[model samples]
Target chain A: MKALALGILAALILLTAPGSQALAAEASEAPGAKPLAVGTAFPDVPLIGPVSPELADSLGIPQNGPTPIAKVKAEALIVEIFSMYCPFCQRDTPTVNELAALIDKRGLAGRVKIIGIGAGNSDTEVDIFRKKFKVPFALFSDATFAVHSAVGQVGTPYYYVLKKTPQGFTIVAAHLGLIHSPADFLADVVAKAGL
Target chain B: MRRIVPLLTLAALLWIAPAMAADPIPGGLAGNIYPVPTLPPTDSQLAVAVGSPMPDFDLPTITGGRVKLSDYLGKKNLVITFVPAAWTPVCSGQWPGYNIARDIFEDNDAALIGITLDNIPTLYAWTRQMGDLWFPVASDFWPHGGLAQKLGILRSDGVSERALFLVDKKGVIRFIDVHDINARPDLGPLLEAMAKVHAEK
Candidate 1:
């Protein structure tokens, strides 16, 4: 009789608790919150660049091929997924241009294709910003945002450096920032994929 | 010489006191909502204070027009509000709050602009989708949260964290309220700020 009473008391407490549903919702959400940080072999799903259409129309890139830039290309690719009007990216570009200069100074320019992909905008907007920021690299247009969708990273100026190895192209590092400094950024990138 | 000295001292005191006036810095970032002593002592977290200068911006508007941080710096003051994405619930409630205050903003020679990462097409569709018609909803779409990111208000993932900023015509920020994804900016505080801006200086 005592045990049955305690069980009944427990059931009543659970049923009548204030904000219980919200607590349960939080409990259910915490674990599901994706913590896929650096080194998580970025999903293999095909992604659309912000400017892929312009490239396809202009250069016949991928030539209707499955992967753009390929799952395997260089030692590593420094990809900047951006939208033309992203305010943080505007601030970040000057910083990114500095890093690009350092990479050029280090003779890693072509080897490290510092690329930009436009998210859901016309090719022209991306081009205008590229000129405004003087970011020498061509911005890829992701007409569908498939790439942004696959990575589940939606922030502009979100950067990903993927290194191709005998295994496959895997993400070395990714950051969304007003980066602390250019050297610190390079250090993190170099540490992961080697200078 | 002695009488001249007191007059000089009084003039100096008058000039120095207002600059010493401590602007109330807001606290309660991350979750709690209280006023902190000053602008964040550290930049570790992506938060801005109420009276700090609103981070600057120059971007293309939805209708092929250009918008600058300075153009709308109203003759009196300005309010800049950022919403996470269009078509969300709390934003639905929050944006309309700005709309309802439109008349008061105009009367005081103040202006309000709502900014977000959603493109103009999406912004237009969503506003109409939700039947929001009062204030201008500016798009931060192409550059993808760039303005918010500079302000340290963009989330690590993609969507923006809801925020509202009141900037004076002098380009000095007078009010800032950045909320977590779920929290909403209380319209009462904004109404109070508007009142203060209109109050005779």
Candidate 2:
């Protein structure tokens, strides 16, 4: 019994120590899968934020208004996928708001547009929420998660920064969570983008 | 030189009697995945201090009113239960569990609220289908997951992870419990936590 216990303990300690499961998980990321890393080329992510958009034209959703993709203007774009009801997205608002404020402060707001792509929500819900949260950034609604599916954003504030390149818009950076204090990160992105 | 080792080293850890006697209930955790600045007035991170001024968001109530967190102040304690999404296993079990706890909150002069990333229509339909009673299920839908993400409980998949909170009459978060995304919360522990809070002066 004692031998069995010590063997199990040793295995556990060794497995949990550095150079174990964590490394395996990192190694397993898909080859083409963008790490939300710096300098990765961001694809031209298509988006449709109209709430509950339908396959048939009779749905009476807006026929115009740039199809929601035009909002990603300027040389650099910070696109965030979000849903109003998501608590994590809501929690990250202050950080997002701070990012917007930083852009405005640095005069990079014009050069780097912040587009909020809201999915899994209704148009009315998105509109009401947009005004409520005081999201100074452009807020678009993706009714059936079309944009979310297109960009393959896993969750809200799945941030992807894109800068205009010769071929098209190339991704500059992608951050997974609300880590870096909002202001500092936004400033760094703007500086990196040279905007 | 030969020395006999004392039995204390083995005995100290071989105390299986206590282990066998301990309840199965889990204890507090190691590193917290979600960290928030400690604020007075609320016990749990899930609940905010009543009357302490709710956070800024124009979330709509299931009932007819548009409310900020401040609107519920001074009237009654708010029970905010945030789950990942509807129709999932743990959440299906969790929502019904809250429905079961309605009586307890009613006795405590509180209101029960459920928030999720599902659209209002989906929330309404799910609530009705699940046979939930007087509880209100709010949709944080448009922002997709504005609330849970802000609460630091949003999972990588854009859904709100399971989290529960009890806000007292003063709008202070009284009971907060966040669990592993896959795990269902313990109703018994939640009840005990609420009871302890209610018993407080």
Candidate 3:
């Protein structure tokens, strides 16, 4: 009798558990949540790690695998959400490379850093993109979409500039589509980032 | 009271679980359904067949100017990709996937030509959002799916099948794929097909 009663209890829990219910609530809430806009403090979102080798080499940062966003040692950071299969991302490659070049040319490399999160792409796909475009910045794959969820990303080729402040970081700017001109993009970033 | 409360909470969880599965992605398109079409279009009279010479047509392009199939025959290979329509889920992302694979087509000395029943303006606007497609996008819109109908892949829905036909240097149909309208064909098969045709030369 006790065994039968225990089996019934287990079945009830599997069929109607609060833990699973809570997870579903969270999933529903994610899509409806207010997006982080400019001037809003950047949330302490967790980052997927083992940063790409090329990016680590470019930034001269030692690869201390699986680092957090808070641990990134930079005055300001530009986060680009992209995907390998996204044609817009492919088309936007040269412009992004230009931004990286401008940062280096203007000597902003020491203060400003750019990193890309490949939304819904695998590491191999991200590697293909990095190689194809010869990207000079760090790019990470967020195949599980954790990073995308953190940023509330709607599509690829999204941009967000985060300025480091004493109290962590604040989003300085956000753009939805292509940055038509590299010079203008740099100027806007410099002005908004207050660098 | 506490024992009864557990049962009540369980009932609530059961009531809400299924509804929660359809949560929307924030700032994303709503009512986005990707039901894979089960019934493949019945095999109709196909226009071009294997070992047959592809018929030439000067169809209007999305980026202006017309594309003539015979023009590329002597100089380069050609791959014509025909998707069903605009704004559909799979169709929206399909061409963009090809946009990134420009090198694959270039290496094989082939040019990709995307076609659809939609008019030039529709293709222009839709492809513009797809970002700088390196290939020419054509419209088989004039005769209301005339080109696709000639190829015999046009479905009864007045749209082309998600098809691909690889024509070699002699303008011969070397490979063809009348892919499932509901599915995105893998790129590997296309690449392999390109290699096979390249070897024949």
Candidate 4:
């Protein structure tokens, strides 16, 4: 009876642990798929747009044609996987914009680049989301869900921080759901990326 | 047993605390959204046609007001969308998407009306999870999908079809998309259609 009670307590703790719901949800949403872990190779998914010249220069990619994420010229890259249809993403727009601004304010803009991919959203749909939210970073359209599939079909507002390596990029940290505080999140990214 | 009771109670408290805390956006990604099974592409035949007058409706909205289809006849173009029911996979994901597209609708001088066969109470509960929507959501419940039936989209299983009807300022249906039941209809064609209708004299 003592052993059974202990087992029940452990299960309850695991179930109610912070972020446990999101983890369980991610597993159910994409069965057999796993979240990209720290020290794992970040997928070199092709991104559709960086329409503006400045954004292109920042990412070290061309204005046209699909560009692989590995080609981005930065010491660290923050990739946000989102969906226009996600209420959470819509609500987190302001905080995400603040995160980009915080990066610039901290003088990490040169070493860190932030970008977003709209999972399953068409180009027009992406544009609408961008305009409505006034997002500062370059956003790519995953109209065909190619990027979404390549990245494990994670839920919206998912964040991945990657550190540039000689061979390619390495996932340093991954977060699911809202960035509670832009300053704190960027600080963590800066610390994780060692920049 | 007495010692174990306190431990179990502490575990329960930890489990309930986070859920009870005020969430800025309730029913968000972490909220109660259910996954549905893949359904047939198209379940019912459309009764309405392009260029025909869409039947006017005065349905109860989730906001506790009646929205008449003819209200925007001369002033604004309209996009009427009918999904099977509320709280399902595609239906839940669809309208929240439109929340961010308020500008698109405003730019084209169009109003979007979302309708489902669920009652107003159910719709009110369901949409609350989607956050505040920019457009009105009306219920077609009392008559049991009366408008859906008039539009010839009520499925044999008693739910409405996943469909879209673009009605111009003159109340003429300009475009119709009886999309596949399981998939989300691409927004490109609808935007193009709205642009076309907005450009018309």
> Which candidate comes out best when scored by TM-score?
4
Whole-structure CA lDDT of model 3? 0.73
lDDT of 1 by residue, B1-201 (tens): 645554555556545534433224211111111222222212224646665776788766555676687786656587888877765544544553344345667876787788888888877765653334466668877678878877787766566767777788877777777765664545556756767877746
Candidate 2 CAPRI assessment class: incorrect
What ordering of candidates by DockQ runs from best to worst?
Answer: 4, 3, 1, 2
DockQ by candidate, in order: 0.01, 0.01, 0.06, 0.25
Q: Pick the candidate with the highest lDDT.
A: 4
Model 1, A14-91: lDDT tens digits are: 444542322211010111123246676656544333434544443334534445465424566677777554444655
Tell me the spans in candidate 4 whose CA falls farther than 4 Å from its real position.
A1-33, B1-30
Evaluated on CA atoms against the true complex, candidate 4 attains a DockQ of: 0.25
Query: Candidate 3 chain B — worst ten consecutive residues by lDDT sum?
Result: B25-34
Higher TM-score: candidate 1 or 4? Answer: 4
Single out the weakest 10-residue window by summed lDDT for candidate 2 chain B: B26-35
Model 2 is docked with a DockQ of 0.01
* Ordering by lDDT: 4, 3, 1, 2
lDDT computed for candidate 1: 0.59
Tens digit of per-residue lDDT, candidate 4, span B108-191: 999999999999998998888677888999999978989998999998888888999999888999999998888778888999
Task: Give the native contact fraction of candidate 3.
Answer: 0.12
